[model samples]
Target: MTVTFSYRSRQTWADPWDDYRALRDEDPVHEVGDGQFWVLSRFDDVFAAARDTATYSSANGLTTAPDDMAGFDEKARPIVMMDPPDHTAMRRLVSRPMTPRQVAPVEDLVREFVTDKLDAVADAGEADIVEALFKPLPSFLVAHYLGVPTEDRVLFDRWTERIVQATAESAAQDGPNQQAFLELFEYAGGLIERRKADPGDDLVSGLVQQGEDVASAMWIVGFIFTMITGGNDTVTGMLSGSAVLLDRHRDQRRLLIDDPTAIPNAVEELLRLTSPVQNLARTVTRDVTLHGTTIPAGKKVLLLFASANRDEREFGPTAGQLDVKRRIERIVALGYGAHHCLGASVARLQCRVALEELLGRFPDYSVDESTARFAAGWSTRRYEYLPLTTN
Candidate 1:
């Protein structure tokens, strides 16, 4: 038996869990599109490849789509597309502000955002979770964190969504969105210039001061774009996906509602289940053999984090099932090693705070599955809109 998969296919994105299981069981190291790329679906294999950055490089591009992979000088690529010393240096420029300790204070602001949104829906007892809470909360927090002016937050939100959609379109092989890219780059440049002169207590200002000479102006703009897209998009997926998961798995929801301290760990379980970032492509630096397949050098290899998270070898027989209390020793949901997501702490903080507030307030809330619509994306699987009824 053989399982075929391609990131460019809508069917693959529609539902990949079943195909992932087949690939893991039959061919852990599977090829797609006549050697377009190789996929590593097993937990151990994906984990090893992600950590071994030297062998599996991110310098070429992080996305699998050929169209999206073009037109970027290696030197000026986003931090996600850089490896080691350069990636290390670029990441350090803004790491301090995103650390767990640094983001602790941001939790209060997150709680406020969640509380306010949930409050608006209290009277109606029904609202689209994505629209009411999940969507705006992340954008608002990101705007505050980056020091974007309150008046310009609307523009920030619009730009982030456009960029994220453009990304999805590229992944689906729908042409690249040059307009969105240019618009965001221009906006980010303006913000960077403002930060340079004003120097506020925000991530952008910190990057300008620290990277004034160390990094190029374009890199700073790229960093800001990375932060904006990463902060807004992934967090929304995690929260909205968790809502759908919890709504389906009421037992787990009850557990979290019963014990709020368990929410943090539950967040991890949800991340693993949701697997917001489905997979990212890494350019292979050397010919690497895994599970009887020798993937040649200069090949694009995708580390299927979503499949690996549910791998039974590492997660036991109930890997496919949702178990919020399941003690997870390790999971590649956020990723691993040097390229691990920089905005991870901030994302976790936002999701944790959102869940704590949402569950506490509307424990009986049920998702109107008929109205639920998920994004048609390859890299990230998230809800476009999820209607909820508290009745």
Candidate 2:
């Protein structure tokens, strides 16, 4: 049986597991788009491709979309697009402020933010989880984490949303995408300058203090852009997706409510199941053969992290089921290798707190699947709106 894989297919997101199961079992190295690129669905294959950065280079770009895709320029691309020494340097500089120790202090703030957001809708009986909780909580927390001024968080949120929307679809050519990029550059540049003049104990200030050249400043802006764009949407998707999943899997949700300590593991399980950033593209530096299929050099390979996370070979027979109690030794939801998500810890912290607070307040809450809407785009999966009934 030949399985056709197209990231843009609505049915792909509507029922991705069926598609992924077919890919993994029938064609691990499935070619799509008349050989425009290759898609890797099996767990071991995706893991190898991600870890073998030498052969699967990120230097060209990470999306299966053509090189002409919007915002594909080297200078504007996120650190995820870079490989080797450059990636190492930028990742090192950006990782400092996001270390576990640094992110630990923000847990209190996350709790407060989650509580306040949840409290606002507690009396309403029903509210759109995406609007009231998922969207604002991450946007505000990421802004706080980035040290953006309280007065400017709204603009920061707007800028991040614009950039995410602009890049979510490869074929998108929206003018606002470029406009948002320029505006964010200008804004981040000003912040960088201010931090340089008077360094503070914030991430931006840390980036400024570590810089010794103009290129460092450019990286500073890049880091900020990456943080805002990377940090916000993924978490938003994770939280909203969690709500929908938990609603469907009441028994698993009960496990978290009964044992709060399970929240941490639940967070990981949710990340695995949701795999918010569905797939990322990598450029093959050399011809490589996998699972008896050879992808030529300079070709684009799409690593389906979402599919890999559910591979039966890795997660056992129940890979497709939601088992919060199932111990997963490792998950590739955050990507693997040199470009692993720098904010993974922060995202976990936020999700744990969000779940604790949300489940505690609305233990009996349920999702209105009839009205729920999910944003389109295989690159990143997120809920546009998730209405919840508190009763």
Regions of model 2 farther than 4 Å from truth:
9-12, 68-77, 170-178, 212-215
Residue pairs with backbone atoms closer than 3 Å in model 2 (clashes)? 62-281
**Tens digit of per-residue lDDT, candidate 1, span 93-160:** 77888899999988778888789888989989999889898888878877887889989988778777
List TM-scores for all candidates, in order: 0.94, 0.95
**Per-residue accuracy of model 2 over 1-391 as CA lDDT, tens digit each:** 8898877533346567888899999999999877799999998988988899999888877777667335555555578778887888778866876778878988888898888878878878889988897887778866776678888878888888787776665433578778877888899988888887887777788767765552467766777877776887798889988999999999999999999899998899999999998888998989989889999998999999999999999999999899888888888899888978988988898899989998999999999877777776667788877899889
* Backbone clash pairs in model 1 (N, Cα, C under 3 Å; residues 3+ apart or in different chains), count: 0
Counting clashing residue pairs in each candidate, in order, gives 0, 1
Q: Cα deviation of 113 in candidate 2 (Å)?
A: 0.4
Q: What is the lDDT of residue 295 in candidate 1?
A: 92
